[model samples]
Target: MSLFHFSIRIKSSRLCLLNIKVYFCFALAICLLGIKAEVRANDRYEIVINTGVSEKALSVNSLRSIFSMHLKTWSDGTKIRVFVFSDDDQLHQNFSKEKLNVFPYQLRSTWDRLVYSGTGQAPIKVNSTEEMLTKVATTPGAIGYLWRADINEKVNVLEIK
Candidate 1:
């Protein structure tokens, strides 16, 4: 083949390879963004309280105290009944770590200390989010956490400050 033709073919082949690389990179970026969006969606949750509870908001410190079985009453003199799922539950773990800024194991130890020391009681444990919603909705002064998708009008969402 002529040198001019050979050079033109090489240039065309390189351009084709470059186009493939660009398309691959673009596809990879789109997949990564999709994964990140899914992660963000999974992380969503809410802290729910019984509608009877007067408080509409609470500091993160107060929430941590309540979960740790330290704060036993609301500001209005009513008992604050805290409910939670199992320590290994994903929602429970996320709530403990994200909202309370504590690990599930740490919360477990705190509850154990309170129980063993005769100074406090652990939060009520429910097996599922359905039970959590029902208990918190029916019980006065009840507080619990639930996935955002599981929340309904029966309970009031408490804003964390």
Candidate 2:
């Protein structure tokens, strides 16, 4: 083949490879963005309280204390009923780590110690998410966690600061 033709072929081949690389990079970026969004979605949850509770918000420490069974009553003298799923539950694990800034194992240990020592009581454990919603909605001064998608008007989402 002529030198001119050979050079043209090489240039076109390089351009084609460059185009493929660009497309690959674009696809990778899209996949990464999708993964990041899914992770953020899975982490989304709300701290719900019974509508009768007077408090609309709580500090982070107060929330931790309530779940740890250290805080027994609300500011208005109403009993604080805390609900929880099993220690191994995904939602529980997420709440412990993200909201309470503690691992699930650590939270479980604290609850165990409280109950064993007779100094405190562990939070009420509900078997299913539906029951959690029902109990928290019907019970007075109840507090619990729910996936953002599962939240309804029956319970109030408490703000944590």
Candidate 3:
């Protein structure tokens, strides 16, 4: 090949390599985003109770009853004070849907019916996750939901069987 053609071929080869590098970087970014999303999706919340409480594990049905205000006390007869975030809160909504198998609105309806009918009371609503963690960690007989990242050593995570 002539000198000019050789130089041209080298430039084209370099350009092709550069294009491949760009495509590879783009694919890597997409893969990383997918991985991040998967990890985030799996980072779910846990049902937490005060450290002083007696229970270590609870059945899903019983947990539902507690949040629904049907079960008022623990098995040991201590008053179970349930704490929750606002109905629209994402963590609260996820906990209600995933753990209780009910939507947040459904939980509100149940609490409202009980409260208005003079059968039971609603949960104590907090403003933020920080408040939730603090209240549940400090108060005796307190039960609430918290994101796994927000959980601290002061609170006990209740296992739902």
Better TM-score candidate (2, 3): 2
Q: Give the Å shift of residue 153 in candidate 1.
A: 0.8
In candidate 3, list every pair of residues with a backbone clash. Answer: none
User: Candidates' TM-scores?
Assistant: 0.74, 0.74, 0.73
List candidate 2 stretches off by more than 4 Å: 1-43
What is the per-residue lDDT of model 1 for residues 14-99, given as tens digits with 9 covering 90 to 100? 99999999999999999988752113333589999999999999998999889988999999999999999999787887788778
Over 1-161, each residue of candidate 3 has an lDDT whose tens digit, in order, gives: 69999999999999999999999999999998875211234247888999999999999999999999999999899999999999877777777766788988899999999999999999999998889999999999999988888898989999888
Which ranking of candidates, highest TM-score first? 1, 2, 3
lDDT of each: 0.91, 0.91, 0.89
